[model samples]
Target: MALLGIIRRWHLRDQIPIREIARRLDISRNTVRRYLRSETTEPSYAERRSVSGLDKYSVQLSGWLKAETTKPRKQRRNLKQIHEDLKELGYAGSYDRVAAFARQWKAGQTEWVNSASKRTH
Candidate 1:
């Protein structure tokens, strides 16, 4: 959006040539022209459907997080520790994924945090 704004400003306000705009912006002339012609803020992207390395571990992680709520803050395991535990349990995801999961879990909403409300098989 910001890039598109600059492109629009340079083209509509300053009346700069497209090639010059592309040169100054260090982007392709085609890209600058595409944005200049486009009416939308940005081109839409499809949602990613790939399975996460963490997907397999989600249930286990959710259980651990649920159990942690009973512990005092000082006694509760941190994101890194939870991530490390996931690692031991064959979780192939990155620490960021685990940390994100931990944050949502701690919030008591979204993702695995809502698992308690879900009907189990």
Candidate 2:
């Protein structure tokens, strides 16, 4: 967005050359042109990237997470513990992979709860 703003200010306000804008912004001339012509602040992105690294054990991981939600926070399994358990079950991914998926799942759960509460109230 900031880059787009810079391109717009330079092109529209100062009548700067696209090549000059590209050079100043360290971007391609085509990129400068596209940003100038774009109507929105954000770039459009594809939704729902196909994730497969944790797909093999996602169900088991979800089950563990759901079960943990009923337990006290102190007693709940941490990411490292969960990663270790998945490893024992033949998961060949890194700890970072497990942690990242766990975070995404937890965030989705939070949003679900928030929307449910909003609808009920």
Candidate 3:
């Protein structure tokens, strides 16, 4: 958005040529022209859709995490141990992927608990 503003200001206010703007900004002249021609203040980009290798094993991992919450703190499996367990099940992704999923899952659980507590109060 800032780049778009700079491109507009340079061309409309300062009357800088498209070729010069492209050279100064190290961008394509066509890109500068497109920004200037567009009426919208912000450029729109296609939404990104990314799939993780862990997607296949997410349900199984979630089940294990939920079960662990019921166990005594000392006996519960930590993330490393859970990663090892997933490896035994043929999950090829890195431990970091598992850890990230766990963090997201824990966050969702925390939000649910907080919301439920708020309703009761």
Candidate 4:
């Protein structure tokens, strides 16, 4: 819209060349020429960053998560337990982060689902 206004003002009022207008506006000559010659409007540009975590322990996390799926005594460890274990193993993360990841992983376990859903409600 702003580009169209600039092009219209230059072509209809100032009589400037497309290249000159482009240079003065610090936009591309092709963009100015497109406005002067073509019918399509410029599209808006937006970049979307991915949602994946940088510190994903997915592989190790998965194995740990699988162990957690068993009954409390049978389960190798819980998140708080995992957090402590990870700390001992040189993992640099907050208990909250470890807990949060565990919660997400546990979401897939049917046995944990009822308890998690009940807590959420």
For each candidate in turn, the TM-score is 0.50, 0.64, 0.67, 0.40
Clash list (residue pairs), candidate 1: none
For model 1 the local lDDT of residue 15 reads 95
lDDT of 1 at 32: 96
| Deviation of model 1 at 61, angstroms | 0.5
Q: Across residues 1-121, which tens digit of lDDT does each residue of candidate 4 receive?
A: 7778779689779999877898888989888877777766666779885554416565777787776655577546657787777777677767887777667666667667787899997
User: What TM-score does candidate 3 reach?
Assistant: 0.67
Ordering by TM-score: 3, 2, 1, 4
- For candidate 3, list the clashing residue pairs, or say none: none
Please report, as a residue range, the 10-residue window in candidate 2 with the lowest summed lDDT: 42-51
Native-referenced Cα lDDT, model 3: 0.94
Q: Worst ten-residue run, lDDT, model 4?
A: 49-58
Model 3 ranges with Cα > 4 A deviation: 3-38, 44-47
CA shift of 83, model 2, Å: 0.9
Per-model root-mean-square deviation over C-alphas = 7.5, 5.0, 5.0, 10.7
Candidate 3, residue 33: how far the Cα is off, in Å: 14
**Per-candidate local distance difference test:** 0.86, 0.88, 0.94, 0.73
**What does candidate 2's lDDT look like per residue over 1-121, in tens digits?**
7788778888889999999988987889998888877788866668977867689899999999889999998999888999999889998899998888888999999999999999998
Cα lDDT for residue 83, candidate 1:
90
1 or 3, greater by TM-score? 3
* Model 2 score (lDDT): 0.88
Clashes of 3: 0
